[model samples]
Target: MKDFSDFFRNPHVWDREIVAVGGDLSSERLLYAYKNGIFPWSDQPILWYCLDPRGIFDLSKLHISKRVKRKINQKRYTITIDRAFEQVMRCCSHRPDEETWITELFIKGYTEFHKLGYAHSIEVWDEDGKLGGGVYGVAIGNFFAGESMFSFTPDFGKIGLFHLFEILKKDQFTLFDTQQLNIVTLGLGAYQISKKEYLRRLESAVGTGKKWTPPRVVF
Candidate 1:
Protein backbone atom coordinates (compact mmCIF):
# COMPACT_ATOMS: atom_id res chain seq x y z
CA MET A 1 0.00 0.00 0.00
CA LYS A 2 1.16 3.50 -0.78
CA ASP A 3 2.00 5.80 2.08
CA PHE A 4 -0.75 8.44 2.12
CA SER A 5 -0.12 9.37 5.71
CA ASP A 6 1.22 12.69 4.56
CA PHE A 7 -1.12 13.14 1.60
CA PHE A 8 -2.75 16.12 3.29
CA ARG A 9 0.52 17.83 4.11
CA ASN A 10 0.23 20.08 1.06
CA PRO A 11 -2.38 22.36 2.69
CA HIS A 12 -3.63 23.28 -0.80
CA VAL A 13 -5.76 20.17 -0.94
CA TRP A 14 -7.72 21.35 2.07
CA ASP A 15 -9.53 24.13 0.18
CA ARG A 16 -10.68 21.88 -2.65
CA GLU A 17 -13.22 19.09 -2.33
CA ILE A 18 -11.44 16.81 -4.77
CA VAL A 19 -8.24 16.59 -2.81
CA ALA A 20 -6.57 13.76 -4.65
CA VAL A 21 -7.08 11.47 -7.63
CA GLY A 22 -5.61 8.20 -8.93
CA GLY A 23 -4.97 5.77 -6.12
CA ASP A 24 -5.73 2.12 -5.55
CA LEU A 25 -8.46 1.39 -2.96
CA SER A 26 -6.15 -0.57 -0.72
CA SER A 27 -7.49 -1.23 2.77
CA GLU A 28 -4.68 0.80 4.26
CA ARG A 29 -5.45 3.74 1.97
CA LEU A 30 -9.20 3.51 2.65
CA LEU A 31 -8.62 3.53 6.41
CA TYR A 32 -6.37 6.56 6.21
CA ALA A 33 -8.72 8.44 3.89
CA TYR A 34 -11.83 7.82 5.99
CA LYS A 35 -10.05 8.61 9.23
CA ASN A 36 -9.20 12.02 7.79
CA GLY A 37 -12.73 12.71 6.45
CA ILE A 38 -11.83 12.01 2.82
CA PHE A 39 -13.65 9.40 0.74
CA PRO A 40 -13.49 8.17 -2.81
CA TRP A 41 -16.54 9.29 -4.78
CA SER A 42 -15.73 8.20 -8.36
CA ASP A 43 -13.69 5.60 -10.22
CA GLN A 44 -11.60 5.49 -13.42
CA PRO A 45 -8.98 7.77 -11.87
CA ILE A 46 -10.67 7.46 -8.45
CA LEU A 47 -11.84 10.87 -7.32
CA TRP A 48 -11.41 11.46 -3.62
CA TYR A 49 -13.36 14.26 -1.95
CA CYS A 50 -13.62 16.12 1.30
CA LEU A 51 -16.70 18.20 0.69
CA ASP A 52 -16.98 21.61 2.31
CA PRO A 53 -20.51 20.88 3.47
CA ARG A 54 -20.28 17.37 4.84
CA GLY A 55 -23.46 15.35 5.29
CA ILE A 56 -23.90 13.64 8.66
CA PHE A 57 -26.49 12.20 10.94
CA ASP A 58 -27.03 13.91 14.25
CA LEU A 59 -27.44 10.80 16.34
CA SER A 60 -29.19 12.67 19.11
CA LYS A 61 -31.80 13.98 16.69
CA LEU A 62 -32.48 10.98 14.43
CA HIS A 63 -36.12 11.05 13.39
CA ILE A 64 -38.14 7.85 13.43
CA SER A 65 -41.57 8.62 12.07
CA LYS A 66 -44.62 6.92 13.51
CA ARG A 67 -45.01 4.94 10.31
CA VAL A 68 -41.49 3.57 10.57
CA LYS A 69 -41.97 3.01 14.26
CA ARG A 70 -45.09 0.99 13.54
CA LYS A 71 -43.18 -1.03 10.98
CA ILE A 72 -40.51 -1.75 13.59
CA ASN A 73 -43.13 -2.78 16.08
CA GLN A 74 -44.54 -5.26 13.57
CA LYS A 75 -41.17 -7.09 13.51
CA ARG A 76 -41.68 -8.09 9.91
CA TYR A 77 -37.94 -8.10 9.22
CA THR A 78 -35.04 -9.45 11.21
CA ILE A 79 -32.04 -7.24 11.83
CA THR A 80 -28.42 -8.35 12.15
CA ILE A 81 -25.11 -6.58 11.98
CA ASP A 82 -22.02 -7.46 9.98
CA ARG A 83 -24.00 -10.06 8.06
CA ALA A 84 -24.33 -10.23 4.28
CA PHE A 85 -21.85 -7.38 3.88
CA GLU A 86 -20.80 -7.93 0.28
CA GLN A 87 -24.38 -8.63 -0.66
CA VAL A 88 -25.46 -5.34 0.85
CA MET A 89 -22.86 -3.51 -1.22
CA ARG A 90 -24.01 -5.29 -4.36
CA CYS A 91 -27.61 -4.39 -3.60
CA CYS A 92 -26.64 -0.78 -3.11
CA SER A 93 -24.84 -0.80 -6.44
CA HIS A 94 -27.84 -1.95 -8.42
CA ARG A 95 -29.86 1.27 -8.29
CA PRO A 96 -32.62 1.48 -10.85
CA ASP A 97 -32.45 5.22 -11.53
CA GLU A 98 -29.07 6.91 -11.29
CA GLU A 99 -25.63 5.53 -12.03
CA THR A 100 -23.78 4.00 -9.10
CA TRP A 101 -20.34 4.75 -7.84
CA ILE A 102 -19.85 1.38 -6.21
CA THR A 103 -17.49 -0.11 -8.72
CA GLU A 104 -15.92 -3.57 -8.61
CA LEU A 105 -12.85 -2.02 -6.99
CA PHE A 106 -14.97 -0.57 -4.18
CA ILE A 107 -16.57 -3.94 -3.47
CA LYS A 108 -13.17 -5.66 -3.37
CA GLY A 109 -11.67 -2.96 -1.18
CA TYR A 110 -14.53 -2.61 1.30
CA THR A 111 -14.97 -6.38 1.51
CA GLU A 112 -11.33 -6.69 2.55
CA PHE A 113 -11.92 -3.92 5.06
CA HIS A 114 -14.92 -5.81 6.43
CA LYS A 115 -12.76 -8.92 6.80
CA LEU A 116 -10.32 -6.83 8.83
CA GLY A 117 -13.15 -5.75 11.16
CA TYR A 118 -12.95 -2.13 10.03
CA ALA A 119 -16.12 -2.26 7.92
CA HIS A 120 -19.63 -3.44 8.88
CA SER A 121 -23.10 -4.06 7.48
CA ILE A 122 -26.60 -4.05 8.93
CA GLU A 123 -28.83 -6.52 7.13
CA VAL A 124 -32.63 -6.78 7.06
CA TRP A 125 -34.12 -10.16 6.23
CA ASP A 126 -37.66 -10.86 5.14
CA GLU A 127 -39.88 -13.39 6.93
CA ASP A 128 -39.17 -15.85 4.11
CA GLY A 129 -35.43 -15.77 5.00
CA LYS A 130 -34.33 -13.62 2.11
CA LEU A 131 -32.37 -10.37 2.04
CA GLY A 132 -34.77 -7.49 1.85
CA GLY A 133 -32.23 -4.68 2.25
CA GLY A 134 -29.32 -3.36 4.30
CA VAL A 135 -26.70 -0.69 4.84
CA TYR A 136 -22.87 -0.91 4.89
CA GLY A 137 -20.03 1.32 5.99
CA VAL A 138 -16.58 1.64 7.61
CA ALA A 139 -15.89 2.28 11.26
CA ILE A 140 -12.83 3.78 12.86
CA GLY A 141 -12.99 4.36 16.57
CA ASN A 142 -16.37 5.96 17.32
CA PHE A 143 -16.92 7.32 13.82
CA PHE A 144 -18.95 5.38 11.23
CA ALA A 145 -18.99 6.46 7.58
CA GLY A 146 -22.09 5.01 5.92
CA GLU A 147 -21.29 4.13 2.32
CA SER A 148 -24.71 3.18 0.98
CA MET A 149 -27.94 1.30 1.58
CA PHE A 150 -30.53 -0.48 -0.59
CA SER A 151 -33.99 -1.88 -0.13
CA PHE A 152 -36.01 -4.51 -1.95
CA THR A 153 -39.14 -4.01 0.10
CA PRO A 154 -40.84 -0.84 1.21
CA ASP A 155 -39.11 0.77 4.20
CA PHE A 156 -36.77 -2.20 4.64
CA GLY A 157 -33.65 -0.07 4.28
CA LYS A 158 -35.02 2.46 6.73
CA ILE A 159 -35.50 -0.35 9.24
CA GLY A 160 -31.84 -1.24 8.88
CA LEU A 161 -30.89 2.41 9.43
CA PHE A 162 -32.96 2.59 12.58
CA HIS A 163 -31.25 -0.48 13.96
CA LEU A 164 -27.85 0.84 12.98
CA PHE A 165 -28.58 4.05 14.87
CA GLU A 166 -29.56 2.07 17.92
CA ILE A 167 -26.32 0.12 17.78
CA LEU A 168 -24.22 3.26 17.39
CA LYS A 169 -26.00 5.11 20.15
CA LYS A 170 -25.74 2.07 22.40
CA ASP A 171 -22.00 1.95 21.79
CA GLN A 172 -21.65 5.71 22.48
CA PHE A 173 -20.43 6.52 19.03
CA THR A 174 -19.71 10.24 18.50
CA LEU A 175 -19.96 10.63 14.75
CA PHE A 176 -22.12 9.25 11.93
CA ASP A 177 -20.79 10.50 8.64
CA THR A 178 -23.13 9.87 5.72
CA GLN A 179 -20.88 11.71 3.19
CA GLN A 180 -23.72 12.97 0.97
CA LEU A 181 -27.32 13.88 1.58
CA ASN A 182 -30.33 12.54 -0.28
CA ILE A 183 -34.08 12.83 0.25
CA VAL A 184 -34.16 9.50 2.04
CA THR A 185 -31.39 10.51 4.40
CA LEU A 186 -32.82 13.98 4.85
CA GLY A 187 -36.14 12.50 5.83
CA LEU A 188 -34.27 10.39 8.34
CA GLY A 189 -32.88 13.62 9.88
CA ALA A 190 -29.49 13.87 8.23
CA TYR A 191 -28.04 17.37 8.00
CA GLN A 192 -24.96 19.13 6.70
CA ILE A 193 -22.13 20.75 8.60
CA SER A 194 -19.17 22.72 7.43
CA LYS A 195 -16.02 20.76 6.70
CA LYS A 196 -14.19 22.68 9.39
CA GLU A 197 -16.70 21.65 12.04
CA TYR A 198 -16.84 18.09 10.68
CA LEU A 199 -13.07 17.66 10.80
CA ARG A 200 -13.01 18.86 14.36
CA ARG A 201 -15.65 16.35 15.30
CA LEU A 202 -13.93 13.65 13.26
CA GLU A 203 -10.63 14.18 15.05
CA SER A 204 -12.24 13.86 18.45
CA ALA A 205 -14.33 10.87 17.39
CA VAL A 206 -11.39 8.98 15.87
CA GLY A 207 -9.12 9.51 18.86
CA THR A 208 -11.64 8.18 21.39
CA GLY A 209 -10.66 4.57 20.57
CA LYS A 210 -14.22 3.35 21.06
CA LYS A 211 -15.19 -0.15 19.94
CA TRP A 212 -18.50 -0.91 18.18
CA THR A 213 -20.13 -4.14 19.29
CA PRO A 214 -23.29 -5.31 17.56
CA PRO A 215 -26.37 -5.70 19.63
CA ARG A 216 -28.24 -8.96 20.18
CA VAL A 217 -30.57 -9.94 17.36
CA VAL A 218 -33.49 -7.59 16.76
CA PHE A 219 -36.67 -9.35 15.70
Candidate 2:
Protein backbone atom coordinates (compact mmCIF):
# COMPACT_ATOMS: atom_id res chain seq x y z
CA MET A 1 0.00 0.00 0.00
CA LYS A 2 1.39 3.38 -0.98
CA ASP A 3 1.53 6.11 1.66
CA PHE A 4 -1.46 8.17 0.58
CA SER A 5 -1.59 9.35 4.19
CA ASP A 6 -0.18 12.68 3.12
CA PHE A 7 -3.08 13.14 0.73
CA PHE A 8 -5.29 13.95 3.68
CA ARG A 9 -2.82 16.55 4.94
CA ASN A 10 -3.46 18.84 2.01
CA PRO A 11 -5.10 22.08 3.17
CA HIS A 12 -7.85 21.97 0.53
CA VAL A 13 -8.93 18.54 1.77
CA TRP A 14 -10.55 20.05 4.88
CA ASP A 15 -12.71 22.49 2.90
CA ARG A 16 -15.14 19.84 1.66
CA GLU A 17 -16.86 16.62 2.59
CA ILE A 18 -15.46 14.75 -0.37
CA VAL A 19 -11.71 15.04 -0.24
CA ALA A 20 -10.98 12.69 -3.10
CA VAL A 21 -12.59 10.61 -5.83
CA GLY A 22 -11.82 7.71 -8.12
CA GLY A 23 -10.04 4.85 -6.36
CA ASP A 24 -10.35 1.10 -6.30
CA LEU A 25 -11.88 -0.42 -3.17
CA SER A 26 -8.89 -2.56 -2.38
CA SER A 27 -8.42 -3.60 1.23
CA GLU A 28 -5.30 -1.51 1.58
CA ARG A 29 -6.98 1.60 0.20
CA LEU A 30 -10.07 1.04 2.32
CA LEU A 31 -7.99 0.59 5.45
CA TYR A 32 -5.99 3.70 4.74
CA ALA A 33 -9.06 5.79 3.94
CA TYR A 34 -10.91 4.67 7.07
CA LYS A 35 -7.89 5.12 9.30
CA ASN A 36 -7.76 8.72 8.14
CA GLY A 37 -11.43 9.46 8.76
CA ILE A 38 -12.58 8.84 5.18
CA PHE A 39 -15.02 6.35 3.60
CA PRO A 40 -16.31 5.48 0.14
CA TRP A 41 -19.87 6.67 -0.33
CA SER A 42 -20.66 5.55 -3.93
CA ASP A 43 -19.26 3.66 -6.88
CA GLN A 44 -18.94 3.93 -10.70
CA PRO A 45 -16.62 6.85 -9.97
CA ILE A 46 -16.25 5.96 -6.25
CA LEU A 47 -16.80 9.09 -4.16
CA TRP A 48 -14.78 9.30 -0.95
CA TYR A 49 -15.99 11.47 1.89
CA CYS A 50 -14.86 12.73 5.23
CA LEU A 51 -17.79 14.50 6.70
CA ASP A 52 -17.68 17.19 9.35
CA PRO A 53 -19.77 16.68 12.46
CA ARG A 54 -19.16 12.97 12.29
CA GLY A 55 -21.81 10.71 13.80
CA ILE A 56 -20.99 8.11 16.43
CA PHE A 57 -22.52 6.03 19.20
CA ASP A 58 -20.85 6.58 22.47
CA LEU A 59 -21.40 3.13 23.97
CA SER A 60 -21.61 4.56 27.47
CA LYS A 61 -24.42 6.88 26.39
CA LEU A 62 -26.49 4.42 24.29
CA HIS A 63 -30.21 4.66 24.98
CA ILE A 64 -32.30 1.50 24.71
CA SER A 65 -36.01 2.14 25.01
CA LYS A 66 -38.13 0.03 27.36
CA ARG A 67 -39.99 -1.46 24.41
CA VAL A 68 -36.78 -2.50 22.72
CA LYS A 69 -35.55 -3.90 26.00
CA ARG A 70 -38.65 -5.99 26.28
CA LYS A 71 -38.09 -7.36 22.81
CA ILE A 72 -34.52 -8.29 23.66
CA ASN A 73 -35.65 -10.08 26.81
CA GLN A 74 -38.12 -12.10 24.78
CA LYS A 75 -35.19 -13.51 22.81
CA ARG A 76 -37.25 -13.90 19.66
CA TYR A 77 -34.04 -13.96 17.67
CA THR A 78 -30.58 -15.38 18.25
CA ILE A 79 -27.59 -13.12 17.61
CA THR A 80 -24.14 -14.08 16.37
CA ILE A 81 -21.07 -12.27 15.07
CA ASP A 82 -19.69 -12.72 11.57
CA ARG A 83 -22.05 -15.58 10.93
CA ALA A 84 -23.51 -14.25 7.68
CA PHE A 85 -21.50 -11.21 6.65
CA GLU A 86 -22.09 -11.07 2.92
CA GLN A 87 -25.74 -11.96 3.39
CA VAL A 88 -26.12 -9.02 5.75
CA MET A 89 -24.53 -6.68 3.19
CA ARG A 90 -26.89 -7.94 0.51
CA CYS A 91 -29.87 -7.27 2.72
CA CYS A 92 -28.66 -3.76 3.48
CA SER A 93 -28.41 -3.02 -0.22
CA HIS A 94 -31.89 -4.36 -1.01
CA ARG A 95 -33.78 -1.48 0.60
CA PRO A 96 -36.80 -0.82 -1.60
CA ASP A 97 -37.21 2.93 -1.17
CA GLU A 98 -33.67 4.19 -0.91
CA GLU A 99 -30.81 4.20 -3.39
CA THR A 100 -27.92 2.03 -2.13
CA TRP A 101 -24.16 2.29 -2.45
CA ILE A 102 -23.31 -1.25 -1.43
CA THR A 103 -22.77 -2.32 -5.01
CA GLU A 104 -21.04 -5.54 -6.08
CA LEU A 105 -17.64 -3.87 -6.15
CA PHE A 106 -17.99 -2.54 -2.61
CA ILE A 107 -19.37 -5.90 -1.47
CA LYS A 108 -16.45 -7.76 -3.01
CA GLY A 109 -13.98 -5.39 -1.35
CA TYR A 110 -15.47 -5.58 2.12
CA THR A 111 -15.98 -9.33 1.81
CA GLU A 112 -12.28 -9.66 1.26
CA PHE A 113 -11.74 -7.51 4.34
CA HIS A 114 -14.02 -9.91 6.23
CA LYS A 115 -11.95 -12.87 5.08
CA LEU A 116 -8.86 -11.14 6.49
CA GLY A 117 -10.63 -10.58 9.85
CA TYR A 118 -10.94 -6.78 9.61
CA ALA A 119 -14.58 -6.70 8.57
CA HIS A 120 -17.43 -8.37 10.54
CA SER A 121 -21.20 -8.74 10.89
CA ILE A 122 -23.73 -9.27 13.63
CA GLU A 123 -26.63 -11.45 12.53
CA VAL A 124 -30.11 -11.89 14.00
CA TRP A 125 -31.61 -15.27 13.27
CA ASP A 126 -35.29 -16.20 13.51
CA GLU A 127 -36.72 -19.32 15.11
CA ASP A 128 -36.78 -21.00 11.73
CA GLY A 129 -33.01 -20.47 11.38
CA LYS A 130 -33.16 -17.73 8.79
CA LEU A 131 -31.54 -14.32 8.82
CA GLY A 132 -34.05 -11.87 10.23
CA GLY A 133 -31.73 -8.85 10.20
CA GLY A 134 -28.10 -7.81 10.70
CA VAL A 135 -25.36 -5.17 10.73
CA TYR A 136 -21.89 -5.19 9.25
CA GLY A 137 -18.73 -3.03 9.40
CA VAL A 138 -14.97 -2.73 9.42
CA ALA A 139 -12.81 -2.76 12.53
CA ILE A 140 -9.22 -1.82 13.13
CA GLY A 141 -7.99 -2.16 16.66
CA ASN A 142 -10.60 -0.54 18.90
CA PHE A 143 -12.12 1.57 16.15
CA PHE A 144 -15.28 0.26 14.42
CA ALA A 145 -17.14 1.89 11.51
CA GLY A 146 -20.72 0.63 11.14
CA GLU A 147 -21.31 0.58 7.40
CA SER A 148 -24.98 -0.40 7.28
CA MET A 149 -27.75 -2.64 8.62
CA PHE A 150 -31.07 -4.15 7.47
CA SER A 151 -34.09 -5.98 8.79
CA PHE A 152 -36.92 -8.18 7.50
CA THR A 153 -38.76 -8.26 10.82
CA PRO A 154 -39.94 -5.38 12.97
CA ASP A 155 -37.05 -3.85 14.94
CA PHE A 156 -34.74 -6.77 14.18
CA GLY A 157 -32.15 -4.37 12.77
CA LYS A 158 -32.20 -2.31 15.94
CA ILE A 159 -31.98 -5.50 17.95
CA GLY A 160 -28.83 -6.39 16.05
CA LEU A 161 -27.46 -2.90 16.84
CA PHE A 162 -28.21 -3.21 20.52
CA HIS A 163 -26.39 -6.51 20.61
CA LEU A 164 -23.51 -4.91 18.75
CA PHE A 165 -23.36 -2.12 21.32
CA GLU A 166 -23.26 -4.66 24.12
CA ILE A 167 -20.34 -6.42 22.47
CA LEU A 168 -18.46 -3.20 21.82
CA LYS A 169 -18.92 -2.06 25.37
CA LYS A 170 -17.89 -5.44 26.73
CA ASP A 171 -14.85 -5.64 24.48
CA GLN A 172 -13.68 -2.11 25.41
CA PHE A 173 -14.00 -0.64 21.94
CA THR A 174 -13.04 3.06 21.94
CA LEU A 175 -14.78 4.35 18.85
CA PHE A 176 -18.04 3.38 17.12
CA ASP A 177 -18.28 5.47 13.95
CA THR A 178 -21.69 5.61 12.32
CA GLN A 179 -20.29 8.05 9.73
CA GLN A 180 -23.47 10.15 9.47
CA LEU A 181 -26.61 10.57 11.49
CA ASN A 182 -30.04 9.43 10.38
CA ILE A 183 -33.36 9.13 12.19
CA VAL A 184 -32.74 5.51 13.12
CA THR A 185 -29.28 6.20 14.55
CA LEU A 186 -30.37 9.40 16.26
CA GLY A 187 -33.14 7.55 18.03
CA LEU A 188 -30.53 5.13 19.28
CA GLY A 189 -28.68 8.04 20.95
CA ALA A 190 -26.08 8.72 18.32
CA TYR A 191 -24.48 12.17 18.50
CA GLN A 192 -22.14 14.22 16.39
CA ILE A 193 -18.62 15.41 17.12
CA SER A 194 -16.45 17.84 15.26
CA LYS A 195 -14.21 16.42 12.54
CA LYS A 196 -11.09 17.58 14.37
CA GLU A 197 -12.17 15.79 17.51
CA TYR A 198 -13.13 12.70 15.57
CA LEU A 199 -9.76 12.46 13.90
CA ARG A 200 -8.06 12.89 17.25
CA ARG A 201 -10.07 10.04 18.72
CA LEU A 202 -9.55 7.92 15.61
CA GLU A 203 -5.79 8.26 15.95
CA SER A 204 -5.79 6.82 19.44
CA ALA A 205 -8.53 4.26 18.85
CA VAL A 206 -7.04 2.71 15.73
CA GLY A 207 -3.75 1.87 17.40
CA THR A 208 -5.10 0.58 20.70
CA GLY A 209 -4.57 -3.02 19.54
CA LYS A 210 -7.94 -4.07 20.91
CA LYS A 211 -9.18 -7.22 19.27
CA TRP A 212 -12.90 -7.87 18.63
CA THR A 213 -14.03 -11.19 20.02
CA PRO A 214 -17.40 -12.88 19.56
CA PRO A 215 -19.75 -12.25 22.43
CA ARG A 216 -20.79 -15.16 24.60
CA VAL A 217 -24.54 -15.82 24.55
CA VAL A 218 -26.07 -13.39 27.02
CA PHE A 219 -29.71 -14.27 26.51
Clash count (model 1, backbone only): 0
- Candidate 1 local lDDT, 1-219, one digit each (tens): 345956543222468888888877888888878878888987898988888799999878888889879998999878988778899999999978889999998899889988888889999999998999899998889899998988898888888988888888888788999988988889889999999899989998988434456654665
Worst 10 contiguous positions by lDDT, candidate 1: 5-14
In order, the Cα lDDT scores of the candidates are 0.85, 0.85
- Which residue runs of candidate 1 sit more than 4 Å off their true CA positions? 1-3, 6-13, 208-211
Off by over 4 Å in 2: 6-13, 208-211, 215-219
Return the lDDT, model 2, position 32: 80
The CA lDDT at 107 in model 2 is 94
> What TM-score would every model get versus the actual structure?
0.93, 0.93
RMSD of each: 2.0, 2.0
Clashing pairs in 1: none
